[model samples]
Target: MAGTVSGFGRLNRKRSSNKEGKRKKAVYPEKSPTSPLASKLPRKQASSGLPLPEDDNEVPAIGSIYASPPIPSAPVSRLPARGFAGRGNCVDDTVADNALTASQHAPPDSGTVVRPLAGKPSNSFRDANKRPRSLSLDTAETPSKRKVTAFSEDAALVPTKIADAHAQVIADEWNEVARQSGVPEIAKITFINEIDHEPVPPDINTLFTYLDKDCLSSVEVPNPPKAETMPCIGRHPAFTDEGLFTFATDCKIIIECGQDCSAASNCKNRVTQLPRTIPIEIFKTVERGWAARSAVPLVRGQVLGLYTGLIISRTTASKLIGADAAYIFQLDMDEPQDADPSLVYSVDAFRSGNWTRYINHSCSPNTAIIPVARGSAHESLPYTLAFVATQDIVPLAELTLDYDPSEAKTFARKKYREKSRSKILKRKRNQTPCKCGTLQCRGWLPQM
Candidate 1:
């Protein structure tokens, strides 16, 4: 019996020692259970829904669980105040009640009115609901293209005197030449003159005047002795009442006409026999300005005269007949634009002197001229002018043009007078007042 008791006491002491070691280990964080079976079993009590040891610092969930927090069923007045709407302490409750009522009336399964996704606009609203943008329209208006008179019917196609006389001369010449020779010499005299109803001033020479050597000597570039003996050509004609030629360069001077020389015998005779008495106006050129300072007059079947020591600027080179208008030509594009869309042309650039100048400006011109561009050999673009719309003009409409290349400037001073001594003679012959009744109408009176 003593041996049995002694053995039992020894076993108890070992058990107690094991329990003490376990208690000491548990004092620190206890090791997680290593047994798979133990891990599978759920804990009976937990802090924050986790094992007690792992979630020791977390809150407990006794009343917070199925019990719910003690929602103070104390009077609704016991709740806090709301910032918006200043409703009573039951504001949240009231909102919830109202929402419930609204939701009850709404379709079943309808979603709550959630705010739009961040950065996205609400689909419920329309642009009209936003503030109106105020805009001022004072500068929005623009002027219009000029409205000119159309051509007149039942008018003579050409000058009556020239047409009748030339017709007779052509018939007689054909009969005589054909009778004498196997082939008749077909002569087509290109008639070049003013087509507008305006009387060209008798004093203003229609032909261009070359600067005299004496006049040239007065300017910066002294003329050679050879140039002095040479005849002076007519002056560049001015289209605007401003009397300024836009193309006048620093190197060149513009001359005015002393007498009407559209169809004169010669340059010498055209100039009134006054001692260098013909009035001449000079103009200087500047850089970055338009080359065609003045709209050069052109006519159908007329020749252009190129003076020596003068070269067409690259910009205006294309405007020559068989040459594309440099200002408007663009070879890379399918179509070419006009250097000046406002001015109408009767022919493309070709070769002559006075005949080219005779082409007149028409307010309601009958002719529709086409200018073409021919590409250059070295350049991607060409130099050439193709005359289109030559057949469009009627018999008696006045040939006119917008003096300014800009459509706006031309339309502003849309009305212009066609003045000439011959126009007065025709007006008297026709026995009509010199009136077109345009808004910018130049009233009639004899050439005063």
Candidate 2:
């Protein structure tokens, strides 16, 4: 498209050194369906399989996202072979060029060049024989939210570090807060930042405990609530284990078989086994407190990590001390998702959980939690839920979740959506002030 614009010359000829009849490969980001600037978009035939993305903590069917097939497949044939369209197919000389264009181009009032021999057509006023000055990246935008079908093929595109003060700390020390973040060897978590005299976080090991995996034994420690608290974790203690879907009979066979689920190409168990492939960071914020972010550019459908925690029931959670009620995640839909059903299980991350605890809520979040079942088959609910990217995240863009995705939700969510829902109590405050800074801020976090 770039080489062959409406007013441009045909640029499709092969180079002298290129092998005869051989073509160079190109990878392009998918055309945004809602982009107003898109005049012509390459045809894309979306394929559907496990639509919810490859997440290790996901159940067989959690949610759906369209998957683009291999580039050599139907998707690639529709796009051009070469040339970046940054200047688009045609670079219009006369633009209502914004601030960036003005800084990089000669002014219209600056006047024309010296006369050449009689016949040549005059160049545009903005054009000159000399090269333009380099522009700042601030004026440029990253295609973080843009879709790309051929991620693996675009390995040559190296990601650059961004320097937004809000999105990232202005300056930082490359520090590791904890020795291990519970992520796999491939996935990494860097504890960073010390800008503006900010205090470095104390070792998390000194806080409560570090649990790489969920602890099922609620074995009443010398202290209270170290292991999962319950009659509680094993078997459904509730009168009825109604709406949850346990592993299928075949799924149970493999769980008992002890064979690595990877051996089977069609293994349904693989749905919840996809670990994170990107690196993440835990950074402190000014007004909002601690948060998490990706250390590099990330694709839209990638899963970041599991939201590991203690297994506690809604009945048990109701008895949680005061503000501690803010961290229980309702497990697989044991009850209708839309209704505030009194019965169900929840994953409590207050005392024991992983890096996901640091992820804050945003009105317009880039990440979301999807349901994911774990290795244990007998457990009535799924273990270790996951944080899936809702859109492509640029480097250092804060990772966020919508604590209250919809107002018509469950008790734990409504209760913990913020610290509280009403500020009328004791003439003090009830709900925590939301500082997500999105245009869609609901004025207050939905809390009860």
Candidate 3:
């Protein structure tokens, strides 16, 4: 997020920095003739307080030096010094007295001149001068220093104009993404609450900001599908801490043939049922304090609730799953070697609801389920789950994934135990009733 600076404040700050640069440029004089003349001019004399002449032939006192015609000596004779008494006696009467004086005085044609020796310094010279004007080496904006320090200080701020331009480009890119996704209305995400020093956490509050009517948003994904009329299911599977899930759906499935089929026989039923256990082989560390959950068949990854978008892994899934703690599940994948399936629990999260009973028991679901693979061998690992949409989903539509891989009796028994155990425990603890109100709701549930 860009820093929070008022328009005028930013303008003033930019103006001040520009003025400083200009000031530095001005401080060192340049190479113009005037500057040279000023420097060359003899400074005030130490003994007489009179300005000294720069040229060798310039006479100190005009009146006495040119009192008479100049004296010319024999060709080899040395000229007599004229400052003392009787100094004129050695002169011969051939030379004009004013010749030397007139020749030594400044030429009449020199244009109206200001202080001499002042000119704009060259780039090299000005750069040298700027050294002292800049922050000290320990606190400066050298290339490396700029990268590190610019984040917090104006020393690093790109020129305000430059930053604004870059920001505009970013805004344009976001807008384009939104447009291509058929949700041009979402492009309004730019001017929400302007972030400053503090950062908003990746939670429901921050998520809600994207949905705020006043804020601008860009659709991060493209070509989302449309929804169909059906009895929308309300069950939301509890995503494991590792970000995996299993789900239940309210809609029924129909096959091309008369017989009921979970998926097209050609594609195989790999995606239809809940896998036994997702080996913890499909996670990757993307940054410090953050890892990504990857999907095998789709070859896509997500940063859990953070950036819910596509990503790639520098390290393989096994490396990622090995780093985190073990997770367990009741189902297992069809094959051990395949990278596809629903092992993306590391990238999933509950859409928010009852913390418990999030494990939706489904006999069959329209969506495909993948395992959260942690290790190659997969023993002693915890189960994580993830779901993919078989068809289009609408906003606020119930999201589900097939959780129960077994038959009805087995599925019901496991769910009954899980629900009753939690319910009895809640009653013993005198907890507030859960309000989910699912048909099979255990008479009480946890409230948000």
Candidate 4:
């Protein structure tokens, strides 16, 4: 009875082993000959149990325990290992097989996240609370900062604006006159206010007449009895036989050939009495506020223009003191030294002036200012100021004059020490750097 029981146990074990083998064969059946891809796909080698290529272009077949389903025509987007519904933890044989197949054919950097092209769906998983990625077009580049200058800050001040407006009005008035005189529109004068000076009163003519009366009190001369009978130009010490005034002489008591004289209106000595016939313009400069320039070439000793403005007593000038002294011409007649200084007067062109008011100072000047008596009343005072070209002036050359001819001469004194002169010059508050750009520049403009 023991032998028969042992034999039966061995038979039951053998049956169980055979049943397992049959079940494996049923799950993985042989490839069907009628399949469309069966002939084209590479087959696995018997020795290595790996797929071998039939040709370089042949694709290897995927081995599976069961038959594979048809692949879709369009590529399916890859899904993240962690699904949106928390279903990633569940195992699915189809998804695992697809992932494994993709990994074998993918580029080496399989762990990198791939960005989707436009119009394509993105399969990337992201937290709902996080911000979305910004578009590249929205990014902006930063700009560099700029530096401010001293001149720009000073220009913004209120006083400068008011001065500029006043200058513009004056320029417009003169420009109209220039237009009437046949000056081309493009070559018109423009006044620019660079300094703050007292404005000349609107009733300038009345003020000038009164000041002229006071200045003429010292040497008021009566008209000669034979003035109308004979030619005054020939007899006057100021004029030559040709009726031209000698600019070189220091004729202390010369008078204008006025209505009392027999000379004609076109007398050569009467250049200042007529309107400006020369073409000129006022322009802005770097070193000076405004400067005069000749629109046409001028010969040496030619009368350029007249400097006209309100005549004021020296006492009145003292009260109205400021940087405007630069525009004031001291009416010191070429009279005897013993004469009373109280009778001295000055012409202030801070306002109510002509184009010559814009003329700037220079260490070596191209022009000279000469006092000419105009009208019978000006005989004693020499109130009329005339500018004459000391040298031939080219077109567009700036018209400049020595503010103090005596100071200009000091620059050439052999005995004068440069250091001492510089120290004395710098002591004055209004002294400015000379921008005459001449070879004999004295380094500083003469102060009044």
Give all candidate RMSDs, comma-separated.
50.3, 26.8, 40.9, 52.7
Q: Give the TM-score of candidate 3.
A: 0.20
Better of 1 and 4 by TM-score: 4
Model 1 per-residue lDDT at 254:
15
Clashing pairs in 2: 56-272, 56-273, 56-274, 57-372
Please say which candidate is ahead in lDDT: 1 or 4. 4
Query: How does model 1 score by TM-score?
Result: 0.20
State the lDDT of candidate 2 residue by residue for 1-448, as single tens digits: 1111111001111112212222221111222222211111111111112222254333332311111111111100001111112423212223212211222211111122211111121111122111112323464332232222333333313211121211121111111111122234445555453331112222221122323323332211111111122112233211112211222211101111002223233323332233344676667665565678887887655656656555443445445433244455554232233322222345555444556767776767777555433232232122345566767789889998766554313323655455544532323233455677987564444443
Name the candidate that leads on lDDT: 4
Give a tens-digit lDDT track for model 3, residues 1-448: 0111100000000111112121111111222322221112221111111222353222111100000011111111111112111323223323323322222211111232222111221112122212333323344322110122323454224322222232233233333333332322422222111121101111111111111000111111111111111112112321222322222211121001101222223322112121112111111111111111212222111111111110111111112221110111212121122322222112111111111112222223223333222111211112123344334433322322222222222325866667654656556353223222345433221110
Error at 253, model 1, angstroms: 29
Q: For all candidates, what are the clash counts?
A: 49, 4, 52, 0
For all candidates in order, the CA lDDT equals: 0.19, 0.35, 0.20, 0.38
Which regions of candidate 1 fall more than 4 Å away from where they truly are? 1-187, 190-310, 314-354, 368-370, 376-382, 385-387, 396-399, 408-448
Q: Could you estimate the TM-score for every candidate? A: 0.20, 0.44, 0.20, 0.49
Q: By TM-score, how accurate is candidate 2?
A: 0.44
Q: What is the Cα-based lDDT of residue 286 in candidate 2?
A: 57
lDDT of 2: 0.35
Model 1, 16-92: lDDT tens per residue?
11221211110111121121111122211100111232332221111000000111122111011122123232235
